[model samples]
Target: SCPLILVLGDQLSHSLSSLRDAPDGAVVALCEVAEEGRYVPHHPQKIALILAAMRHFAGELRAKGWRVHYSALDAPDNVQTLIGEAERLAALYGCDEVRVTRPGEWRLWQAMQERRDAALPWRLVEDDRFYVTPDAFADWARGRSTLRLEGFYREMRRHTGLLMEGDSPLGGRWNFDHDNREPLPEHLEAPEPPCHRRDATTREVLVLVAEHFGDHFGALEGFHWPVTRRQSLVDLRHFIANLLPHFGRYQDAISDDQPFLFHSRLSAALNLGLLAPQEVCAAVEAAYQDGKAPLNAAEGFIRQILGWREYVRGLYWTRMPSYKRANYLDGQRGLPDFYWSGDTELRCLKRAIEMTRDNAYAHHIQRLMVTGNFALLCDVAPAALCDWYLAVYADACEWVELPNTLGMVLHGDGGLMGSKPYCASGKYLDRMSDHCQRCRYDPKRSTEENACPLNSLYWRFIERHADRLADNPRMKPILGNLARMSDARRTALRKRAEAFLATLDTEPAYGQGAHS
Candidate 1:
C-alpha cells in the first residue's frame, strides 16, 4: 500500500523531502484548516499568502502526474486540524502509513508524536534544505557556556565557502557590523518594493481569508505578497539590483515616512519556502564579487539569511518545549491595549503599528528597537508579546518568532540569546529616527509633563532590575550610573513611570507572582 504524503502551509517547496523521492502512485495531501488560521488570530494576509502558495504548489504537484488531494477551508466535511486531516486522507486513500517533513513549530511536532498508535503510523522525514541540521547545531552547542552568533556565523562561512578566499575571509574580517550602522542621509531615496499582481488563486484566497478571518489583527486591503517562486525571484532580483548597495548603511535607520527604506522584503517568502536560502545568499555573494554591491551591504544581507536565520532555527529546535516559558527577569505585565489598537501617543510605536496594520510588515529596526524594545522595558510577559508578534506578522513561523520575541526581543531567556536586555530610553529612538521631531512628547525630559513615557520607564526598568543586571559586564557601568543618582531624582522618575504603567497593563501577564 502507498503512504500518504502530508504537506503543510509553510512547507511549500517543490523539493520538500516528503515529495522528493516518493513512489509513483503516492497520494499528496495539501490542507487549509480553520484551526490553523485561528490558532493565534493570524493576520489575514498571512493566511491568504500561505493558502495561495499551498494551492499553487498543489497545482504544481498535479501537473507532474502525482495524485493530490487538496482540502480547501470552505469545503464541506473538511477536518479542521492537520493531524486529523492527515489520518482521514490516509484511511480514505487506502494508505497504510503517513509521511511528512518535520514541522516548523514544537506544538505540532509534539501532537504528531502522541499518535504513535494510530491506524496509519506516521513517518517523519528530516528537512535538509538549510546550511545545518538541528542535531548538528546541538552538537556544536554541546558543552558550551555561551553560544555567540559571531562564532557560529564564522564557522558557517568556512563550511559554505561563501565570501572566502581559499581558507581566509575575503574581507580579512568575518563581520562588517561596525561599518553598517550609519544613520540614513536625507539625500538617500527609499526604493519601492515589488508588488505582484494578484492571480485567480490569490484573489480567491483573499476572499476566503476575509470571510473567515476578517477580525484578525492586521488589515488585508493592500495584500500583495509574493506567493509563487517566480514572484519571489522577482523580489530577490529587485533587492540585489536596487536596494542592496545602501542596505547596510541605513539598515538600522528608521523613518516615519518610509516603512521599508532599504531592507529586503524577502523574509516572508523565505519563511514560506517559496525561495531557497542557498540561492539567495549565493546571488548576494556574487553581487559583491562582481563589485555591483559594496562588501558591507552584501555581507550584511547574506549574514541575515545565512547567519541569523539559520542560528534562530537551530536555537529554536535545541531549546524548544522549555524555551517558550522562560521569564528570567520575572516580567509579569500583560500586553498593553495599544498593541492591538495602535492608539498611542508615542510616535515611533504608532508608526510601527500603523505599518504592521496596513502592510503586515515592519523592518528589523522597527521590530527590535521600537515594538520589541518597548515590550522589554515595560516588562510585558514573554508569551503575551510573543503571541502578538506571531499574530501580526506575515513571516512569523513559531520557530523564528519565539526565538526573536521570547529570547532576543524581551530577553526572557535570561542570557541565552542576548547578553543584556535590549532596553533603551526615548533618546535612542530619537537618535535612530526622525520620529521625535513632530511628536507631542519630549525625548530628553523625564519626570515632568509631556515627557516620553519610554524615558522614565527605561530608568524605572533599570532601577527594578539593578541587582539582576549588576553582575552583567555590559550593564555594570550603567548600573553604577543608576547607583549614583540621588534619592529624590530616582523617586520622581519611579513615580512618573509607575503612574504611566498603571494607566495601561491591568491584566495579569501569566500568574500570581513572587516578583523575585
Candidate 2:
C-alpha cells in the first residue's frame, strides 16, 4: 500500500520539501470541498484561480509518476472538513500514515493536530520556506511585550542579510518610506500590464465558478490573472522589467483609471506558492544590484513581502479567533449595500468598487482608503468589514486581511497594526487620482450639489465618534479640527451626513444612498 500525503488548497507548491524524497508509490491528495471554498463566500474569480492552479499543479505531480487523488467541490463523496476527507482517503488507499506541510491557516492547523492525536501517525512537515520560523519569532517576541513590526523588520533584515551592509542598512537608513509616497502626475501614462492568454483549463474553471457563484459580489468576465506557474513567472518578470523602476515612488497613489499602478500584481502567486517569498525578494534585490531598478523601489517592494507579509502571519499565530472579533470603536452600523453592488454615485468610491468587482483585486491604497475608509467612518462593524474584505479580495486570508482591516483600516484594535487610521477627505483622493474628473459629485464641496459623500462623511465621522477618538493622543489633531468648528456649522454638517446615510438600502442606515 502507498503512503498517503494530504495537500491542502494553499499548499500547491511544486518544490514542497515534504513531497521530495518520499518513498516510492506514495499518494498525494488534493481536495476542493465546500469547507475550503465556502469559508467566506469567496469571489468566483478567486475560486477559479485557486482550483485552476491546483489542477494544473496536480497534473505536474502526476507526470512525475506519483499516485495523485484530486477532488472537485461537487464530488459525490464530498466530506466538508479536511480531516474527515483525509481519513476517508487514507482508509481507501489502505495507507498507514499521512504527512502534510504546516498549513497557512490556524484553524486548519488545529484541526489537523486534533485528527493526528486521534487517528494514525500523522507527520507535520516544517514550512522552512518562509524567512522566519514560528519558534524564532516566538523567541524574538519573548518577555519584553509589544511586538512592533518595524523593530521586528529590522531584526529580520539583520538575520537574513537583506537590505543590510554589515550592521546597518545599505544607505545608512533603515526605511525609505518618505521617498516613496509621491502621487501620480496628471499627464503620466501607466505602462500596459502584462497579458496572460487564458488556457482551456482555466476557461473551464472560470465557467464553473461563475455558474456556481453567479450572485457573488465580483465580476468574472474581466478575470485575466495568471492561473499557472509558467504564467506567474511571466507576470513577475514583466513587473521586474516594466514596473519595478517606478514602483517605490507612487505605490500609495490612488486613481480611478489606473488601478494596478506600479504595483506588482504578484500577491496572488505569492499566496498560492507559485512564487516563493525568497525568490521574489532576491529578484528585486538583483534588480537593484543590476541598476535596473532604484534602491527605493527594490527596498520598498522587498519590505512588503519580507516585512509586512511575515509580520502579519506571525501576529496571526500570536493572536487570533478573538482578534477577528475586536471592535475597539464599538461600531454597530451595517455594511452599505453598494459594497455588494458597486452602484454608488461617489466617483472615487464607484471607481474603486468597480475595479474590485471586475478584478477581485485592488492595490493597498484602494482597499485602505476608498472602501475600508467608508466602512470605518460610517461605523460598520469591524468583523462585518473584515469578512467582506476576506470574501472579496483574491489575496485576502484571515491572517493578512483581519489586521489590515481591523487595525489599519478600522483602527478598531486601537492602533495596533497602524500608527493611525488611514482616514482622509475626498481632497486627498482628488489630488492623487483622476477619479474626480468623471464623477457627478464635486470633490470640493462638503454638503452641496450631490457633494462627494466622503466630504460630509469625513467631518461627521469625527463629530459622531469624537468622544471615543478625541482623547486619543494620535487622533487629537483631527479632533481639534472638529473642536474648532462652530456648533451651528457642525450641526449642519451632522444633519447633512445623517440625511445622506439615511438613504442607504441595507442600513441601520449608515449612508443616505445618494446616487446619480
Candidate 3:
C-alpha cells in the first residue's frame, strides 16, 4: 500500500518538506473543504486565490509524476472537513501511514495531532519554508525580558547572512525605517503591480467562489492573483525591477487613488507558498548590490520578509490558544459597519475599506494608520476587528493575522508584539495620506460636531486607558500632552467621543447584516 501524503491548501510549494524523497506511488491528497472557506466568511477573492492556487499546484504535481487525489469544494462526496477527507483517502489507498508537513494554523495542527488514534500512523515533519523554525524561535525567546522584533530581526539577519557584512550590517545599520516614512510626492507615478491573466483553473475557482461565497466581503471580478509558482516569480521580478526603488521611501505613504503604490503584491503568493520569502529577499538584495536599488529600499523590503514577517509567525506559535484572547485594554465595542461597505464620512477609512473591498489588498500604512488606527481608537473589540482582518485580506492566515491584529493593531497583547499601541490622531493621517484633504470632517478639529472621529477618540482612548498606559515609558510624552490640555477642552473632547460611541449602536453589528 502506498503512503498517503496530505497536502494542505497553504502548503503549495514544490519543495515542501513532506514531499522530500517520497517513494514512487505515494499518494498526495489535496482537498477544498467547506469548513475552511466558511470558517470566518472569507473574502471572495481570498477564497478564489487559495482554491485556484491549490488546483494549479495539484496539476503541477501530476505533471512531475506524483500521484495526487484532488477534491473540489463542489465534489458530491466531499466530507466537508480535512480529517474526514484524510480518513477516506487512507482507506482508499489502503495506507498504513500518513505524512504531512505541519499546518500553519493551531486548529488544524491540533486536529491532525488528535488523529494519531485513527487507524493509520501519522508522520508530521517540520515545515521548512520559513527562515526560522518555531522550535528555534522558542529557544531564542527563552530568557528574553521582552520579545521585540528588532532583536529577533537582527538575529535573523545574522542567521541568513542577508545584508550582513561579516559581523556588521551592510550599511552600518540594521534598519532604515526612518528614511522609509516619506509621503508620496504629487507627481511620482507608481508602477502597476504585475497582473496574471486568469487561466481556466482560476476562472473555475472564481465561479465556484461566487456561487458559494458571493455574500462574503470582497469582490471576485478583479481576481488577478498569481495562481502558480511560475506566475508568482514573474510578479516578484516585476516588483524588484519596477517598484523596489521607491518602495522604501513610500512604503508607509497612503493614497486613495493608488492602492498598489510601490508595494509588492506578492504577499498572497508568499503566504500561499507559491513564492519563497528567501528567494524574494535575495532578489531584492541582488538588485541593491547591482545599483538598481538603494540600500534603504533593499534593506527595508528585506526586513519585512526576514524581520517582521518571521517575528510575527514566531510570536503567534509561541503564544497561541491564549494569544487570540489577549485584550489588555478590554476593548468591547463591535466593529463598525463601514469596514464591509466603505460607506463612511471619514475619507481615510472609507478609502482603506474600499481598497480592501475592491481588491483583497491594502498597503501596510493604510492598514495600520487608517482602518486599524480607527479601530484601536474606537476600542472595537479586538476579536471582532481581528475577524474582519482575517476575512478581508488575501494574505491573512491565522499565524500571521492574529498577532498582527491582536498585538500590533489593538495592543491586545499589552506590549508583547510592540512596545506601545499604534495610537494616533487624524493629524498623523493628514500628514501621511491625501484622505484628509477631501474628508468631510476636519482633521484639525477635535471637539466640534462633524470633527474627525479619530481626533477626539484619540484623546478619549488615552484618557480612558491612562491608568494602564501612564507608566509606559514610550507613552509618557502622549500622557503628558493629555495632562496639559485645559479641563474645558478635555471635557468637550470626551463629550464628542461619547457622541461618536453612541452612533456605533446604530450601525449594524459586524457580520450580521448588509452594509447600510
Query: What's the TM for model 1?
Result: 0.98
Candidate 2, superposed: residue stretches over 4 Å from native: 1-3, 121-123, 507-516
lDDT of 1 at 238: 94
> What is residue 447's positional error in candidate 1, in angstroms?
1.4
All candidates: TM-score: 0.98, 0.93, 0.97
Q: Report the C-alpha lDDT of model 2 over 71-102, residue by residue, as the tens digit.
A: 77678896866777877888888888888888
lDDT of 1 by residue, 9-90 (tens): 8888889998877886899999999989987888898899999999998998899798999999998978888999889989
lDDT (0 to 1) per candidate? 0.88, 0.81, 0.88
Candidate 3 positional error at 57, Å = 0.6
Per-residue error (Å), model 1, residue 127: 0.9
**How many angstroms is residue 494 displaced in model 1 relative to the true structure, after the best TM-score fit?**
0.6
lDDT of 3 by residue, 473-511 (tens): 999999999899999999999999989888764233343
Clashes of each: 0, 5, 0
